[model samples]
Target: MNKLLVITVLVALLALSAESFRMPRQAEEDQGTLTKITDAVKTYYTDAVNTVSGYVDSVKGLQLEEKAKTLYTDTTNVMSTYAGILQDQLYHIFYHN
Candidate 1:
């Protein structure tokens, strides 16, 4: 009867220890799932930032191109006006003299 009591106590202790050990494994799996979710969120935000930055840079480049074209057109018009004035002056000097 004493031996039966000892065996029963031992079985109960072993069962409790097994359950304690399994709890840590469950906690570790939960932690791993949380880490995966965190990494996915970080990647999504990083990609979104990169896309927005690229779009902003493209818009800036287009604005600069428009400004450059306007400056070029203004310069061309000024040169044309100057050339026309010079031709008129040369014709007057040659024909009126």
Candidate 2:
């Protein structure tokens, strides 16, 4: 009976030790996924800025200052949208867990 009790305690300790290792492995994976998402968002924002720059140049070339101003305002709106998406993703990743 004493030998059986000792074996049971050892088994439980081993199980918990295994679980400790598993938790950090899962956390590392989650961090990697979050990093990828952040990188993609940065790329998208860069592309958006480039598009606005090109549009401004084209509008200026055509002597359409009013249209250029409107496009600039629209570009600002798009940047705000991107900012909102980034904030939501950060909240979901950091707080939802």
Candidate 3:
């Protein structure tokens, strides 16, 4: 939405600049400059959109099994660590008393 708005504004500016009260040659020159700017902006946004879309597609293409394995490993490791800590505390309080 924001990108569209910016493009719209740039087009509007280009139109306005083309009808400037300046001399004919200057008007033509200004139109060329504005056209170049609009083209550059369009190219930049097109590349950016394509890059982001590619990233999203890559993420979506990930194997669910890989993600599940990672999550499972992380959770198991955390649980084991916490269990060890609790066991140590309990041993010191109940057995070492």
Q: Number of the top candidate by TM-score?
A: 3
lDDT (Cα, tens digit) per residue for candidate 1, span 1-97: 9989967865654454343444645555454544555556558769999999999998997898889999999999999999999999999999995
Candidate maximizing lDDT: 3
Sort by lDDT, best first: what order?
3, 1, 2
What C-alpha lDDT does candidate 1 achieve relative to the native structure? 0.75
* Per-residue lDDT of model 2, residues 1-97, tens digit only: 9989967765654454343444646555454544555556558769999999999998779878778899999999999999999999999999996
* Sort by TM-score, top down from the best: 3, 1, 2
Number of backbone collisions per candidate, in order?
0, 0, 0
The TM-score that candidate 2 achieves is: 0.35
lDDT of 3 by residue, 20-94 (tens): 456545544455666777778779889999999999888879877799999999999999999999999999999
Any runs in candidate 3 off by more than 4 Å, and if so which? 1-31, 63-74, 77-97
> How many pairs of residues collide in model 1?
0
